[model samples]
Target: MFTCLCLISKNVFKRRNKRTEFEILERYKIVLEEGFENGLIWEFYHLRGDKGQEVCRIYTQLGNVDWHRQNQWPEIYNFFIKNMLQLEENFLMVKEVVKEELRG
Candidate 1:
Protein backbone atom coordinates (compact mmCIF):
# COMPACT_ATOMS: atom_id res chain seq x y z
CA MET A 1 0.00 0.00 0.00
CA PHE A 2 2.85 2.45 0.87
CA THR A 3 4.65 1.63 -2.40
CA CYS A 4 1.46 2.24 -4.38
CA LEU A 5 0.93 5.58 -2.66
CA CYS A 6 4.51 6.64 -3.40
CA LEU A 7 4.10 5.74 -7.05
CA ILE A 8 0.86 7.65 -7.28
CA SER A 9 2.43 10.73 -5.68
CA LYS A 10 5.33 10.57 -8.09
CA ASN A 11 2.96 10.37 -11.05
CA VAL A 12 0.96 13.30 -9.72
CA PHE A 13 4.13 15.37 -9.35
CA LYS A 14 5.15 14.56 -12.91
CA ARG A 15 1.77 15.62 -14.25
CA ARG A 16 1.92 18.89 -12.33
CA ASN A 17 5.45 19.57 -13.59
CA LYS A 18 4.41 18.96 -17.20
CA ARG A 19 1.41 21.27 -16.80
CA THR A 20 3.62 23.98 -15.30
CA GLU A 21 6.13 23.64 -18.10
CA PHE A 22 3.39 24.03 -20.73
CA GLU A 23 2.06 27.14 -19.02
CA ILE A 24 5.52 28.69 -18.86
CA LEU A 25 6.12 27.97 -22.54
CA GLU A 26 2.78 29.54 -23.46
CA ARG A 27 3.66 32.65 -21.49
CA TYR A 28 7.06 32.83 -23.21
CA LYS A 29 5.42 32.61 -26.63
CA ILE A 30 3.12 35.49 -25.75
CA VAL A 31 6.05 37.59 -24.57
CA LEU A 32 8.07 36.86 -27.71
CA GLU A 33 5.17 37.87 -29.94
CA GLU A 34 4.78 41.10 -28.03
CA GLY A 35 8.49 41.84 -28.21
CA PHE A 36 8.53 41.24 -31.94
CA GLU A 37 5.59 43.59 -32.43
CA ASN A 38 7.24 46.26 -30.31
CA GLY A 39 10.49 45.80 -32.23
CA LEU A 40 8.60 46.41 -35.46
CA ILE A 41 7.26 49.68 -34.11
CA TRP A 42 10.67 50.79 -32.93
CA GLU A 43 12.37 49.82 -36.16
CA PHE A 44 10.22 52.06 -38.31
CA TYR A 45 10.28 55.09 -36.01
CA HIS A 46 13.84 54.95 -34.57
CA LEU A 47 12.21 55.09 -31.18
CA ARG A 48 11.99 52.93 -28.14
CA GLY A 49 8.40 51.88 -27.51
CA ASP A 50 6.68 51.94 -24.11
CA LYS A 51 8.74 49.64 -21.91
CA GLY A 52 12.05 50.49 -23.55
CA GLN A 53 12.79 53.71 -21.72
CA GLU A 54 11.54 52.24 -18.49
CA VAL A 55 14.02 49.38 -18.80
CA CYS A 56 16.85 51.81 -19.39
CA ARG A 57 15.70 53.88 -16.47
CA ILE A 58 15.73 50.83 -14.24
CA TYR A 59 19.35 50.15 -15.12
CA THR A 60 20.28 53.77 -14.59
CA GLN A 61 18.58 53.86 -11.24
CA LEU A 62 20.28 50.69 -10.14
CA GLY A 63 23.69 51.95 -11.12
CA ASN A 64 24.95 54.42 -8.61
CA VAL A 65 28.04 56.47 -9.32
CA ASP A 66 29.45 55.45 -5.97
CA TRP A 67 28.90 51.75 -6.37
CA HIS A 68 28.66 51.14 -10.12
CA ARG A 69 31.65 52.27 -12.09
CA GLN A 70 31.07 54.99 -14.69
CA ASN A 71 32.96 52.87 -17.21
CA GLN A 72 30.27 50.19 -16.99
CA TRP A 73 27.72 52.54 -18.54
CA PRO A 74 29.09 52.10 -22.03
CA GLU A 75 29.18 48.35 -21.65
CA ILE A 76 25.58 48.17 -20.45
CA TYR A 77 24.41 50.61 -23.11
CA ASN A 78 26.17 48.69 -25.84
CA PHE A 79 24.71 45.41 -24.67
CA PHE A 80 21.16 46.76 -24.84
CA ILE A 81 21.83 48.41 -28.20
CA LYS A 82 23.26 45.18 -29.59
CA ASN A 83 20.20 43.22 -28.54
CA MET A 84 17.88 45.83 -30.08
CA LEU A 85 19.88 45.82 -33.28
CA GLN A 86 19.75 42.03 -33.49
CA LEU A 87 15.98 42.05 -33.06
CA GLU A 88 15.59 44.73 -35.70
CA GLU A 89 17.80 42.80 -38.10
CA ASN A 90 15.85 39.61 -37.49
CA PHE A 91 12.52 41.34 -38.15
CA LEU A 92 13.76 42.94 -41.35
CA MET A 93 15.32 39.72 -42.60
CA VAL A 94 12.10 37.83 -41.99
CA LYS A 95 10.13 40.46 -43.83
CA GLU A 96 12.44 40.35 -46.87
CA VAL A 97 13.15 36.62 -47.04
CA VAL A 98 10.87 34.50 -49.23
CA LYS A 99 10.44 30.94 -48.05
CA GLU A 100 7.55 29.84 -50.30
CA GLU A 101 9.86 28.37 -52.94
CA LEU A 102 11.68 26.29 -50.34
CA ARG A 103 8.38 24.93 -49.04
CA GLY A 104 7.59 23.42 -52.40
Candidate 2:
Protein backbone atom coordinates (compact mmCIF):
# COMPACT_ATOMS: atom_id res chain seq x y z
CA MET A 1 0.00 0.00 0.00
CA PHE A 2 2.83 2.41 0.85
CA THR A 3 4.59 1.62 -2.43
CA CYS A 4 1.40 2.22 -4.36
CA LEU A 5 0.95 5.57 -2.72
CA CYS A 6 4.53 6.52 -3.57
CA LEU A 7 4.04 5.67 -7.22
CA ILE A 8 0.80 7.61 -7.31
CA SER A 9 2.45 10.63 -5.75
CA LYS A 10 5.27 10.49 -8.26
CA ASN A 11 2.86 10.41 -11.14
CA VAL A 12 0.88 13.34 -9.80
CA PHE A 13 4.04 15.40 -9.37
CA LYS A 14 5.13 14.61 -12.93
CA ARG A 15 1.75 15.57 -14.29
CA ARG A 16 1.83 18.83 -12.38
CA ASN A 17 5.23 19.73 -13.82
CA LYS A 18 4.13 19.11 -17.37
CA ARG A 19 0.87 20.99 -16.94
CA THR A 20 2.63 23.99 -15.39
CA GLU A 21 5.15 24.04 -18.21
CA PHE A 22 2.36 24.00 -20.76
CA GLU A 23 0.58 26.85 -19.03
CA ILE A 24 3.74 28.96 -19.00
CA LEU A 25 4.26 28.38 -22.72
CA GLU A 26 0.67 29.38 -23.35
CA ARG A 27 1.44 32.69 -21.65
CA TYR A 28 4.51 33.05 -23.83
CA LYS A 29 2.35 32.50 -26.87
CA ILE A 30 0.13 35.35 -25.73
CA VAL A 31 3.14 37.58 -25.30
CA LEU A 32 4.38 36.79 -28.78
CA GLU A 33 0.96 37.36 -30.24
CA GLU A 34 0.58 40.74 -28.56
CA GLY A 35 4.10 41.86 -29.50
CA PHE A 36 5.65 44.91 -27.85
CA GLU A 37 4.51 48.49 -27.93
CA ASN A 38 7.97 49.83 -27.23
CA GLY A 39 9.29 48.71 -30.62
CA LEU A 40 10.66 45.51 -29.11
CA ILE A 41 10.10 41.99 -30.40
CA TRP A 42 10.02 38.67 -28.56
CA GLU A 43 11.51 35.40 -29.75
CA PHE A 44 11.55 31.90 -28.28
CA TYR A 45 13.30 28.78 -29.49
CA HIS A 46 12.70 25.35 -28.08
CA LEU A 47 15.96 23.76 -29.23
CA ARG A 48 15.14 20.10 -28.68
CA GLY A 49 12.13 20.71 -30.89
CA ASP A 50 14.22 22.91 -33.22
CA LYS A 51 16.54 20.15 -34.47
CA GLY A 52 19.83 21.91 -35.33
CA GLN A 53 18.90 25.22 -33.72
CA GLU A 54 21.78 24.69 -31.20
CA VAL A 55 20.11 26.31 -28.20
CA CYS A 56 16.76 27.42 -26.90
CA ARG A 57 16.20 30.99 -25.83
CA ILE A 58 13.42 33.46 -25.15
CA TYR A 59 14.46 37.07 -25.37
CA THR A 60 13.71 40.58 -26.53
CA GLN A 61 15.79 42.47 -29.02
CA LEU A 62 16.42 46.13 -29.74
CA GLY A 63 13.96 45.97 -32.61
CA ASN A 64 13.30 49.59 -33.66
CA VAL A 65 15.28 51.11 -30.84
CA ASP A 66 17.87 53.68 -31.76
CA TRP A 67 20.60 52.06 -29.75
CA HIS A 68 23.12 54.38 -31.33
CA ARG A 69 21.83 57.01 -28.93
CA GLN A 70 22.61 56.49 -25.23
CA ASN A 71 19.37 58.01 -23.91
CA GLN A 72 17.26 55.21 -25.34
CA TRP A 73 18.94 52.68 -23.07
CA PRO A 74 17.13 53.70 -19.91
CA GLU A 75 13.64 53.37 -21.36
CA ILE A 76 14.37 49.99 -22.87
CA TYR A 77 15.93 48.79 -19.64
CA ASN A 78 12.87 49.86 -17.70
CA PHE A 79 10.56 48.23 -20.20
CA PHE A 80 12.42 44.96 -19.85
CA ILE A 81 12.25 45.14 -16.08
CA LYS A 82 8.53 45.84 -16.08
CA ASN A 83 7.82 42.91 -18.36
CA MET A 84 9.92 40.59 -16.24
CA LEU A 85 7.94 41.52 -13.15
CA GLN A 86 4.72 40.86 -15.00
CA LEU A 87 5.96 37.48 -16.10
CA GLU A 88 6.87 36.60 -12.55
CA GLU A 89 3.40 37.53 -11.42
CA ASN A 90 1.81 35.47 -14.16
CA PHE A 91 3.90 32.47 -13.28
CA LEU A 92 2.91 32.63 -9.64
CA MET A 93 -0.74 32.86 -10.54
CA VAL A 94 -0.48 29.86 -12.83
CA LYS A 95 1.46 27.91 -10.26
CA GLU A 96 -1.12 28.37 -7.55
CA VAL A 97 -3.99 27.34 -9.76
CA VAL A 98 -2.14 24.31 -10.98
CA LYS A 99 -1.34 23.36 -7.42
CA GLU A 100 -4.94 23.62 -6.32
CA GLU A 101 -6.17 21.49 -9.18
CA LEU A 102 -3.55 18.85 -8.65
CA ARG A 103 -4.16 18.81 -4.94
CA GLY A 104 -7.85 18.22 -5.46
Model 1: per-residue Cα lDDT over 1-104, one tens digit each:
00000000123233554334333323333332344433221111112364332111101111233326667667556545654555444434443222332232
Error in Å for residue 15 of model 1: 27
lDDT string for model 2 (1-104, tens) is 00000001122233545444444445544543343344223222233443433222334443456656778778677666765665455445556655566565
Kindly give the number of clashing pairs for every candidate. 0, 0
Residue ranges of candidate 1 with Cα displaced over 4 Å: 1-68, 96-104
Best by lDDT: 2
- Report the number of the highest-TM-score candidate: 2
Give model 2's clash tally. Answer: 0
What TM-score does candidate 2 reach?
A: 0.41
Off by over 4 Å in 2: 1-20, 23-62, 66-68, 99-104
TM-score of 1: 0.27
Residue 39 in candidate 1 has what lDDT? 24
